[model samples]
Target chain A: MDTLEQDIKILIIEVLNLEDISGEDIASDMPLFGEGLGLDSIDALELGIAMKKTYGIELEAGDGRIREHFRNVLSLAALVRHQGKGSLTHTP
Target chain B: MISWDVPIVRWVQWPGIGAAELGFIEPLLRRRLSSLARGALHVANACAQGCPSATFVFASRHGELTRTVELLRSLAHDEELSPTLFSLSVLNAAAGIFSIARGDRAPATAIAAGVESFGYGLLEAHLRARKSPAKPLVYVYADAPAPDPIGPQSGDPQAVFALGLLIQGDASSRLHTAFRPGTMVGTPATLQANACLRALERGSADWTSDRHHWCWNLR
Candidate 1:
């Protein structure tokens, strides 16, 4: 669980071009959008795509809980962890 | 129209400006604006802050190369391109974003005319203004070199430049600018856009690019 959380943080930094930020800077439960990390919808979309490519996890746009799932590193880590047994959307 | 004159109202040039400095572009939409778009918007916002009726003219030699190059690479590798990058890669993406953000339905245009892009962009505004002489035009120009695999390896490759001019004809404070057809055949020592901007700066009243002759004077 800890390793998954750390990896997701690194992924977020890399995929979002947050050059000024480090993995230690983003708290696991802090909000990723609006206020906490100053991220926006486009970053969410880009992160969603990056998560799918990296973990083979398909986070559908239709998912009602999609916004909740992407709130922070913790939620995103749980998402990737449990999504391993779920169905995939894109082939990649 | 080579001898045409455009009265300039307010103008700004921001060289080496980046997206981080453009907080006026709202965090949500700002995230989507590419570096090129950000630079263009930087000048656009600076020149037309509260003027909701401002018509826009966005000019760029290479509009959004970083994202376009990435999308091309993804195609080469058969990788899935993200929807965000694909959407913002258009030539007039900045102008569109500005209009939507401002919720103003004024006319906006995007132009790319090779070596004569800036000169031609200015001409485009004059043509548009001729239709409605009372309407003011906000001309914005910005360009940063395309990256990697297909970018220039050296030699003054468009250094993240952006400029804006609030143009109005027959204004109290008017700077008359004229363009004459010059016989110079090859690329000038300076970039074409740089020639116009340098003229706006402390350079001189007369400037020459590869094939266009430009002159500006304040009346």
Candidate 2:
């Protein structure tokens, strides 16, 4: 996996509290919701917030392609790279 | 005086003062449990063993107050709050998590009655058991001192503990509980739980508060 993809995987694991799984366990292209990681709507919102905090990526709630951007680690990394900025506020 | 012969079928407590053993819960869901929920579920699970389903009465004087305080602090700082934290920062969080984990559809009630949480929780369980004499009733009380500002003046016991009791409406052995108006006195929920435990082990325990007087006697 590329550096950005690896980072996104780590971020997902940390933010979602996937204690039993590691980055190696989550396939870069696997679906993150419903089947692969079994994450739900709460995890989606949490992951979105974490992304905003870490990568300064502001996701519009009404964005039709939001699901596509959060589809998997690779897609999340692409979103971060597309935004190309770090957090502007305290990352607490 | 309203009283009933409430029988305690089983009892358990969590970790003396440390983390509770929650191997039954999947790490995915368990990761969201706060320490208070962890301990409450730990004892509740143990007491509910062998029973297919049971009514649950979960009580805490300061249920998730610590987490609620943290969330409020985050909001005050204009920081983006964690969705997970906000979700679990409720008095009924543990009871909800327990029902989901067990896949049991039995009704669960959460109570926070100031210093009388333990007493009123058992009373609530007794009332529920009387209504449905067939189903088992589990009364679980867990509390930890809340962080400064919100709970310090409440006189909560400094220790953290969870107590579970399996209540049966009719049994060979019985516990007699009574309540009446009395002078108010502040007592910590932990001490109230301990007093109930002592009553079960020995013979009786009683407390006096400005609003009420509560007593328990194993008969």
Candidate 3:
């Protein structure tokens, strides 16, 4: 598994409090919300906060397309790697 | 008259709380719930098992004191309070969780009345029920000693305890309370919750406090 995928998985667990599920159980291409991990909108806001604090990737609180970036571990890993500029404010 | 002897139809209590039992709370809320809130919600859920539409009154002598103290300390140090802590540090935060969880838009209250919190809180619930006699009320009292060095000497033990009373208003008479200006010095337990539950369990006629005598007629 890619290091970014692993990091995102760990972040999701730690941020959302999914004690019932382990990181490895979250498939790289599996959906993250709704039909996937069953997390809701509040979980999204919390994840956004954690993402900014951890990766310094500031997500716009109202970005509709950003939902696509958070669709799965594969998508999130790509988002994190794409923003590898280390610490950047991402406003979409 | 320190008046209020409403009928308590059901009750739920947690003698001691552990984090493992709270796995059911969402991770977002779990991290935010103070020990006080965690204990209170645990018993609230239990007491309100079948009554989601019930009103609620949460009583505590010191609700979220530790969180408030932390915020105060941060302000003193010229540090910004953590957004999550700032949001959840209110006295009513824990009590409001019941309303949120149950999706009940009905009235919910959080109250503190020194050592007489339980009595006064129950009184508040009684008054609330009077407004709409059809709805039942759930009264919750929870307390946990504050975090270190702030009031350790004055604080209660580290134990987190909570009890919930379900008031159905079925009985015409149940409890009657009278206020006294001077302290009567009841048992060592300062929490009104402990006193109230003990009186119920032991079938005592009355529970005495420093300022009031609560007469229970559980017949």
* Top-TM-score candidate index: 2
**Candidate number achieving the greatest lDDT relative to the actual structure:** 2
Each model's lDDT:
0.74, 0.82, 0.70
Which has the better TM-score: candidate 2, or candidate 3? 2
| DockQ per candidate, 2 decimals | 0.31, 0.79, 0.15
Residue ranges of candidate 1 with Cα displaced over 4 Å: A1-3, A17-45, A58-76, A83-92, B16-21, B153-157, B180-182, B202-204
Ranking by TM-score: 2, 1, 3
lDDT per residue for candidate 1 within B1-219, as digits (tens), equals: 255667777788766444335766665566567767777888888888667686788887778878889899999999878777888888888889988877788768999876567777888877787777677788998877768777752213456778888887666655556777778767443556665665556534666665567776555
Give the 10-residue window scoring lowest on summed lDDT in candidate 3 chain B: B149-158
Q: List the TM values for chain B, per candidate.
A: 0.86, 0.91, 0.83
Ranking by lDDT: 2, 1, 3
* Number of the candidate with higher DockQ, 2 or 3: 2
Candidate 3: Cα lDDT at B163: 82
The better-scoring model by lDDT among 1 and 2 is 2
